[model samples]
Target: MSTEPRSTSEPRIAIVGAGPAGLMCARVLHNHRIPATVYDADTSLTSRDAGGSLDLHADTGQIALADAGLLDVFAALARYEDQAKRRVDQHGTELAAFVPDADDDAAPEIDRGQLRRLLAGSVPAGTVHFGHRVTGVEAVGDRYRLRFANGGHADADLVVGADGTWSRVRPLVSDAAPAYTGVSFVEVRFDDVETRHPDVAALVGTGHLFANDGAGLAIVAQRNSGGQIRCYLSMRIEADWPRRAGIEPDDEAAVRRYLLDAYRGWDARFRPLLTDTDSGYLHRPIHALPAGLTWPHRSGITLVGDAAHVMPPLGGWGANLALLDAAELATAIATQPPGTALTGYEQRMWARSGPLAAAANEGLARFAGAADHIPDHRAEHQRYQADAAAYRAARA
Candidate 1:
């Protein structure tokens, strides 16, 4: 297995996972007239739920979209007004609020599904091969071979792992794995909010409503498109609490009882968020790789997005970082020599994501009550907004 840089004239590139990172990479590579194939395990594009909303920051996410020629399309679909944020205590009393100016588009919100669709549609139709579940990756001479669960295989000169936290391709480069962060969220939703659930709609407001007791309990709700409200009852609990407590994930009543007991002394206004829902409950245990993690560069393979650095959703930086990573990686691949491009991309990614990953871990601990003091999230948002503004100005 030679580790030399392969010819750039027609390097065979394979991107694992069709999430934002992989799709963005393919789109950018296509823009440069470089061809890459993306493999995803899902049967189709809409096979699974696309998750919640995301606020793409100007310096990171927006820049990536602009590079891919999707910024104008993104701006048109983004919810600029929904950038407003509200924080409240357990009693539903307002603690702080930050309403963005009418013209403020520093960080605009877009549905996760919407963003995925935009990126997916940007690439060529046949660029993505669905239903290909990668079972393992092996070095074949100077190239790499990907074995799919469907008894199929494909060989590539270079492999990019955008497969996410539990990426199969990650082990080929690093030994680090995602560990539970001692926090879990039971997600619920309310559909037709303005008509069917006006009270819930008002409670959540135009953007996001965070009701934290500062003692490890919170009801965080965000307004999605189509007048729907998605709520996450977050808590610091045992990783296997559901199974140990004999609470089946689908047992909505049991989960509701557990949440009600956990939040026993909270105000009654927050109950509706837990009880009324138009979707099944999703138990999500937060997990993250070690902060500031780095691995020695290996030729013929590298990573992007969550596959490289996954952290808590503290500042909504996960997807933004992933997008930026894809754009940078694609740019490097298109310009630099094969081996040098992977090495340089890894160095740049490490330097950029290390501090943000550390901060996200700390913010998770504070938000989950591992620390003594309650976090001032509103203040944090203001600082982030100001920093983004400064970044754009400096670049301009």
Candidate 2:
């Protein structure tokens, strides 16, 4: 409703997917008085849970939000105390612990749902057209046209693909596909932890705890607002193992039993992490595009976020990089004309993302094997600190 006037000379921009990257891009463009339309598959903003919490890095996520004029709102919603972190062994022994100053905002945690709402709300009401799940994108004489699943179509001078990992728009530019990372997470959530599970809450502390066995098994538990904690029981297993074992996602009891058996040697105290799950388990196998992935420049279309360069989430780079991509792409579009802006954006994006993606992939390998290969928690702790510092420095 608050869109700027459409100029005859201004390119008509169509953004696919209303995730952080797309929303941020649109918000930044709107701030520059550039109008763009965002299309998403969801029927409405609250179509589903927005996944778990995220820690927005200072340079990427925070800066992007600032550019979008939403930093103040983000600060109001950020959970500063969630910076507390700990690493432990199967016996629940703390290998490393970091409790940042309560005021630290360098990388504050925020629920993904909350962040999505803030970004979505920041843009004008009608800017995002919900339920417009894009099915394909095609070039039409120097322009791009989008076809949606629900029998809809639109054409734009510029098409921004923010549709995420399995982006439909990606094919128009690249041949890459997301391949499994040999890692899978059985996601479990517990609600009202402070009241219903005080002991678990105390063990989890203020932020997150990583319990690794140094081989192939690990559990990461992180606290969100509303006294809830989300846990991911991760394993390095065959991609089809779940289906092969007849383990359906909705079979919560079966999943719980499987997890308990897989982590049998783990400390008894950690059992509650699996046994006390409050909802159905979700089997989410991690995947990433080939590291350092890039496509030749094609006019009228480009990608951002997971749609551009997806990597394992081990290095905490996914959301941060996505937000950065959105901001950078928006800046490029705002300054350059349509045909040439994408080249500049892709060049800078690849330079910035290529190394990060490679590092993230390597780090994920180490992280997946930390329980099995790492000699000791102390060494892992040191590596964690070094990686954290390095990421901060790189961003700085």
Candidate 3:
């Protein structure tokens, strides 16, 4: 549940879910000399960072990082010159590739692990309490009392729900929940992609290589910071495909065999990605907040990241929006009273995140299975590229 407004000498804030959103919220708040405690259900911060590479855009993600003073740290870990793009047919025939102009100031790619570690390390060591899964929320005077699964409790003037899509804290503010977008991803990875898996690596190219027919089948490979290749297989299948197929992600051989059987007629190089796998297979079904999910201001409570507005990862706005939310919320609170800042932040976050969320969902809907919708994908992608460049230029 959400928190009730409380009046404290220090404006105690409780941030849930310690991901990019929660950590950034806490980091920004700490920068402004506000006291906040971060809570996460994970046993530790290093639980699991198994997402693919992410390119921090110039507008949202980069700006937010700069505000948090972690731009340099992000750059130090960024994989510049890894922004190649391409589209191919199901048979692996290259269709189009936009030669990218490389610049050190360009969008720098970082492994999801690096981004999380950097953000987690920046927050004060003792500020975060791990293994504290929130069970419920109760209003106490102007503040809220947090109940933990371990019989522990804490009170705060404000509670920020940075927990992801299935946020336990979200139910308190609004009954809105995330719904599936009829898409699911089978995550695949290759070890030492270059030497060990030359053909597959070559098929992947430098950065992103997508093959699709626009209906349901797609193979997208993204190069990670290390010598690993992160691949995503998109399919329009029954929701119970995993159970029906009896697919055991832990069984690498079975997973590889399944891939071979599924995409049998596709290019041989593309087949080995699933064939020669080093890591376990994983599934992620995209879910998003409805078109315009907003709620009335609930004093002492707000949301950031997926908890606030979950959307598909087409534009990679998940972490970026959370970072921006952190910077904006902290700034608002520092410059005004609790009532004003909390209310103002919610209004702005809802208005600001709606369109980005829509755009992300749109990308997943069209581009997920329709990578080869050539004329359309190319025209749309270029327009976005130009828009991104323009945004960066204008900011500069």
Candidate 4:
């Protein structure tokens, strides 16, 4: 495929989805004095729960934030002391523990809602159109047209699909879709943990706790801001396990009982992580696209983040990769012509994310059975610090 440089100095770019990838792209473009429009399905920024906390790695996620000129603000809101981690067995025995040094900021934790609000605020006002759920993408003569579910239409010179797993613009470039990964999570949260759930707070500590049973069952909890703790009870089960097991999703009590039964051999100490919750249960069936997925470059259309190469959440690489993708794409567009920039961005994104996606898949598969030994979280953090130091040195 060949792309010609736009005759006009500026091209009309339309970005689908206002998640991390889309919003970061818009913010970076704004920093470069380029204009782009973003459309999101949510009615507002607070339309739904923004999920849990995320640790932004220095090399990837932080670099993107620095480029968008929000790193300083992020520092103020980041929780540096929450970098601690622990892993335990079904008997509530500690397998491993890692606590970062006081000065270490390699990957600091921040709530998803706070991060989204920070990025959204960095972009120009009116740049994002909420409630504009896109239905389809159609190719016109030389441009792409977006059809919204609200019977609205818009055409643009370039279309970016940062719409995540079930992207509406993905089919225009590739035929790949996310597939269920044979594992699911029932997510629940406890509010005011230090006061209402002191025991749970102590179990979770300042960061994350992973409790695993050798037989394909695990409970993971992480501390969020506002004195809340979010927990996920995960198991290797079919995608339709709820339906097949005759469990109504809306029935919280039924789901809790089912989870308790499933986790039957585990220590009684782990029960509160499943039973005491301030919010309703959220059933999440994990899914991912094929590892190292790539598509032939099509003119005027491209993808970023999960839309390009979505994999199972392992090592918290998904959001970090998305932030890097947005920063790189925006930089390319600012320095190069439209067509060449899109192609170059795609190639670089594929090369960078392919191996990470493969590793994530392998990591997710480990949940199938109990491992002979647990990973050394301290060693992993040291490696990440070394890598980040090298990256900074090279860039300097």
Candidate number of the best lDDT: 4
Candidate 4: TM-score? Answer: 0.96
TM per candidate: 0.93, 0.91, 0.90, 0.96
| Residue runs of model 2 more than 4 Å from their true location after superposition | 1-9, 371-396
The digit string of per-residue lDDT tens for model 4 on 1-396 reads 211223366688899999999999999999999999999999999999989999998878998899899999999999998888888889999988888888988889999899999999999899899989999999989998899888888888989899999999999999998999988988999999889999999888989898887678888799899899999888999999989989887988988888889988988888898799899899988899988888899988999999888888767899999999998999898899876999999998998899999888877777556655566666776777787678678858
Task: Tell me the tens digit of each residue's lDDT in model 2 across 42-154.
Answer: 99999988899998877578878877888899999889888778888999988877777545567788999999999998888799999888888888787777888888788
Candidates in descending lDDT order? 4, 1, 2, 3
Candidate 3, residue 348: CA error in Å? Answer: 2.2
lDDT of 1 by residue, 1-396 (tens): 221234557878999999999999999999999999999999999998888889898768988899899999999899988888888888988877778877777778999989999999999989899999999999989889889998888888889999998999999999999999999988888889999998898888988897888889887799788777899889999989999899986788898788788988889888888788889789989999998889988898999989899999888889999999999899999998886998898998998899999999888877777334445544655666677677668747
Q: Between which residue pairs do clashes occur in model 3?
A: 5-142, 5-143, 6-142, 6-143, 214-369, 214-370
Which regions of candidate 4 are displaced past 4 Å? 1-9, 392-396
Q: Which ranges of candidate 1 are over 4 A from the true structure?
A: 1-9, 370-396
Clashes of 4: 0
Worst 10 residues of 1 by lDDT: 1-10
Off by over 4 Å in 3: 1-8, 104-106, 248-251, 372-396
Per-residue lDDT tens digits for candidate 3, residues 34-132, read 767898888887876537898776667777787788898988898876766788888877788854555534455788888888988988878788889
| Candidate 1 to truth, TM | 0.93
